[model samples]
Target chain A: MEYPAFLPAGDCALSVEFGDAIHPEINARIRALREALERKPIRGVREYVPTFRSLLVLYEPCVLGFDRLVKKLQARMAGLRGVAEGKRRVYVIPVCYNGEDLDFVAAHARITREEVVRLHCAPDYLIYMLGFLPGFAYLGGLDAKLHTPRLQNPRTKIPAGAVGIGGEQTGIYPLDSPGGWRLIGRTPVRPYDASRAQPILYAAGDFIRFAPIAMVEYADLERRQAAGETIWEVREA
Target chain B: MSSGVDRTLRIQSPGMLTTAQDAGRVGWMASGFSRSGAMDLPSLRRANLLVGNDKDMAALEMTMTGVACIFGCDCVFSLTGADMCAALNGQPIPRYTALQARAGDTLACGGARVGMRGYLAVAGGFDLPAVLGSCSTGLKFGLGGFAGRKLRAGDALPLRCPEIPVSRLSERVLPVPNALDAHWRAQRPGMQLRVVLGPQAAHFTAAGVEAFLSSWYVVTPASDRMGMKLEGKKIEAVCGYDVISDGVAPGSVQVPASGQPIVMMADCQTTGGYAKIATVAGVALPLLAQAKPGDKICFAAIDVREAQRLARREAAQLRRMEIW
Candidate 1:
């Protein structure tokens, strides 16, 4: 693979662009560079924000100049071997397909509610990156049949753990906030819990599979989650 | 008040949107958190310095309107940023100067006369617990700073009381003009912000880039802590406005499909899908923060090296003020 172009984001930050579009290989390369930087930490590197096709790095100008920082990154990239593919964690999240917009999504897709649930559960969606809101994972690999447009008028508040789809992507809302996605199901497990050692549950390379559950099971899982019990079953992907 | 325990401030009223802010929350962007801090960072640092607090110490960030609070114990405090016509016991207090307050004394602040946000820093900084390595409030995520929300009436904020006598230090320290205050005053009538042409500068037409540099953009009422939306000449794009979502930094000038620019601020989202035409230089962020609705701002494109030089110069100036 060709080395990514290092573009100046601003005086304080720089972007290492992997490609123009989002692809699994491009994302893996981005994550590889991030992991490399983490292992051999660069001086004055403050933040590393990984996206679909690039990694935005913020640094203090006082400690490290932009040119020098880019040189260090380039040197690291030269030593990086084939994409560092670690064992990706697959989380089994329990979801109840009884969302307020489930019927709307079914009608829009020209399928029954049962079909909607099946299509959603079939794929182990890849976690692209986390953004928009805290713990909100941008998942790719949604079934082409489930591709639906966002709401014309977004709802004011989407509850936490609400599974929704917008365009080619489907994600879980980690917090109650105004969103434009079409909600088709609700998950019992919290994607974000501040009290946890690691606040966010999943990383960029992880995979998530939705396990359809009944209303009774959803209520039981919700109760267990509130009591600080692990709800999602995790295993090596 | 107890003799040895920490001092505190009882909020009588929180005007507009008052939240505890510091330098910023760093190293958390990967977890989808923005570095939410004071919009006018220079002012916050100056206010903290005046009260002999750490430069990045937590302070009250008052927006549009100021706050009204009563001192639970004796302390020295300073007000900086927007001159909100602050008063101590009905008598007006001067901006950028530290004043001693006794227990039960009320500090009332009125609406800003010039800038949008104001800073109130106490002697030893607020005793707020740092969440995720920062006390700066991230209101969207509802984390950090005084219960991770805006300061409301009846909220009591604990202060780190000085072990030594602060009275002597307060008297010895004279009010001096800080470099930040001087730089802010120097750019009075002309609101020109220096920006660096972007990582996606080629996405716009030459005419669009020219329009952005030459035309004036008015600050719209839709502006807030998240971003400042501007209404001005349309910046036509050559290859449309959408981009694969990417990580956004503060002061990014993102132009959407509508052609209008939105300057991201302190509490902006971690990632955005709009194409960024330019990024406002770090040194000019304070100036942009002070701009209110209807204010007209012109952009001047500077090279990345020049932006770094300006940032370094500002840092040097701030360091020089330590001796004064």
Candidate 2:
């Protein structure tokens, strides 16, 4: 399905909203639009940020006015009518089911905690967007059984590496910040680092799977991460 | 026009909060880049004019209080905005005036008494690395200006002293605006900002739109470059469309779920989903920058053409005022 072009964001940028609702197909188109822009950048184009259901393209007004830029973007969209291919990457992230909300989540879903883990690890999730905070990925395809609401009162500080679930979406808190999601486990990798060449570890179109591990192994992995050793058997799946 | 590198300004004491800033980072909002730069562009411009520098030159943005420093060599510099009481080895120096500081002499600025921010501009521009087209410091994303962070007490500042014809600020050299400047230059009374109706203006009810322009809103303590959260009548829409995320710009006023209007300033995020009621014009940005907490403000409606006219007129006046 094609999307409608939006008006200027301000004086310098424009937007193209794929759809009003959150759907997998719409998100895939959003990714496709990003790739299209990446492949053939506009003259005055500075950056293109892809969101869950839309894409924002910022440009220099001096080089290309709002009207001219919009026309250029529209032409690009029309050129890619039928061939919308979103690039995808698959990653395996190990986790331990033992958590403060593990038992509570099991009771809420009317299933065992182990069963909850089984359902969660079943499907490969796709990253729809990267927002709210830097390196915080908004992953889709969460297990229906594990779908849960946010906390009544957000915690003052959710530690970095926390793997959390909110509704049908699951995410990892790349940095220590105030959050209200239910944390099931954590990953030791630095999902975000400003000093690094690539600040964000994962981008949109990447696939992710959470692998279950024993509690002792979690502690051992933490030690390994602290010692600057690779924790996960992180290989491209 | 091309000269050699001049003496580097050695830092003696980094003040409370100081960072290198140029005009601002633009053209990267779609990439989630914030427009992080000097909060007060007018003050920076005035200071730059005093030193005969371009409007886009990099300067030090000091907040509230400032640090003590010793110039490595004699150089012409100007200080503007706020009564910080800058001094040379405890001797008082005039504000909004350029002065030559000799080497081995210490310069310091006291705390702000009226305003929250200040600008200190050297004869030439400050030597700093430009990141993604600007040297503006954005600490949140950690990009641009002094390693993308605040200047510490021990940090050193480099200088590029261009040997151009010296220009002093007097009646002859000072920027003389035209009739428009003479009329509008009278510092606007109070904090009310003139705005053009937003793209989402249609979403608001007639009463909600009326309340938005008629009522007075207070600038809260939580206000910063990211946005100004106004406290006033809670505006409710006739219907809410969980707006699809779209690009946003500086000066866009977004009315979120809480009904409070958040006026985005420089350093705001690239895009948001809130229903924006209006957008402050770029020409009026200087006035918005001077706003302080507890300041009561109102909104006045304007058309897009009027906004563009105001911006163009301001640019023309600015060009006529400066040598560049």
Candidate 3:
């Protein structure tokens, strides 16, 4: 277990970074800290935000100013390395393999389109972090054979739930946003819905599997979701 | 004071681009939420002060004016910012001075003759259910304000007055100077934005980093609450480098592929992959908030201690305003 230095992110916030390189263990610790903070919020703590390898904690300036908060955080961090044990949840996200860049990715991977789908679904990828957009989970453990670069020119607007790969990671767009990731498929599930008790269905450290579905099935899922339906199937991992 | 939803103000005209704003949203930046709220912090504070409302009280933020409202009940209110040529029931009213309007009087605010934005504050503050503990409108994320959207015609806003009127403040409060005030001379416009060099600051070439500190940047016309598109030194690493997606905050300076440094503002998304060079000190955020499009700004580097002191002093000044 390793811990990097803690530093100020900006005024009113401090970032405790774990490591420079993206590692599964480091990410797990990050998730653990996030969980612990949420489960037991500090008195003056306003926010505890997680990144790839760091946790940015924001507190109210009036109640617990930066200096005092830093001391409290330092004491808290001294013993927070071992409380990450948990039961992880695995979700099966159905994706329609009809993205605009699916063909280009298959060509780059030197495989047929069918094989790309198979490899993508074979591994149970872990959610490393939740960032960029709401419900947009950054999943690790992509198949090396499926590694691809982001598009040279990003699309002006990638449809919501468009699943794509960039470098060694893959994620779903929670909203209709401009992106540059290499697109491969799109899911029908609303990655983020404000009305739900838990707006984000997935969190860091959870595992996810992308099961490719037919275009017709995608259309049906979209319809059911629009009518306020639960689109994902959850299984304990 | 009704236990029910309280008296509601019906919109006769929704002003040009009125939106509800309070202190911004928090804790959801990693979820791609922007802390969208009032653009001018000091003025917003003043407006809240005049009404004896909490500093985080929600107010109607009018952009460039044309908003007309009707009081639902007898209430006390105050207006701040550019002379909107406001009137109460066809009688020309004064800006920056608290006014008492009876129920059914139409309060109209016209276009700006000076500044860009104006704030309207009720005695108790606008009544609205806070999303994430804020009534600030972030139209891009559809998070807060009235349904997380801009105010439109016929949108009836709820009014909730405090139990007592502002007995402390005199009825007349002078208009806040559109320019920096004499009180702020000690905090003089540093023109230079203090920054704590970011983790990605090392990614750029030494020369590039030096240029960033040395050069002057201007806030472009394209700037808004989301971010400021700056025109200055085209800063880059030895080559365009790819950085892992990371969390961002307001006042972060990011150099995208275009090589121009874009300073993220109040409405900026929480996370981004761009190589962030620096984060401007939060004490200077209010000054940045007051910047108009095409305003000239320069970056000056200061240590974190100085930034904290500056923030403390400014906050103390704000607290002192309560006495008057």
Best by lDDT: 1
The i-RMS of every model, in angstroms, reads: 0.8, 3.3, 2.1
lDDT of 1 by residue, B220-257 (tens): 99999999999999999998999999999998999999
- Clashing residue pairs in all predictions, respectively, total 0, 1, 3
Interface RMSD of 3: 2.1
Compared with the true structure, all predictions reach lDDT values of 0.87, 0.72, 0.76
Poorly placed runs, candidate 3 (over 4 Å): A1-3, A65-67, A98-104, A149-157, A166-168, A180-183, A214-229, B1-16, B64-68, B81-96, B104-115, B165-194, B204-215, B236-242, B257-259, B320-324
Specify the poorest-scoring 10-residue window by lDDT in model 3 chain B: B181-190
Best by TM-score: 1
How do the candidates score on chain B by TM-score? 0.94, 0.86, 0.84
List the candidate numbers ranked by lDDT, top first: 1, 3, 2
User: For candidate 3, what is the recovered fraction of reference interface contacts?
Assistant: 0.33
Q: Between which residue pairs do clashes occur in model 2?
A: B15-B67
True contacts kept of each: 0.68, 0.16, 0.33
Docking class of 3: acceptable
Tens-digit lDDT track of model 2 for B1-324: 234423656666676677777789764543356777777776777777777788778788887676678777667787776557789879998766767776667889878754656788888778887876798998776778887888877566777764554444322234322222332345544465778776577778888899999998888988877887889998778788337655576788899887888888777876678878777766665566656677667888866555655765666666765864
A138-198, model 3: which lDDT tens digit per residue? 7888999899988888889988889999988888888898999988999988778777767
Quote the TM-score that chain A achieves in each candidate: 0.95, 0.90, 0.90
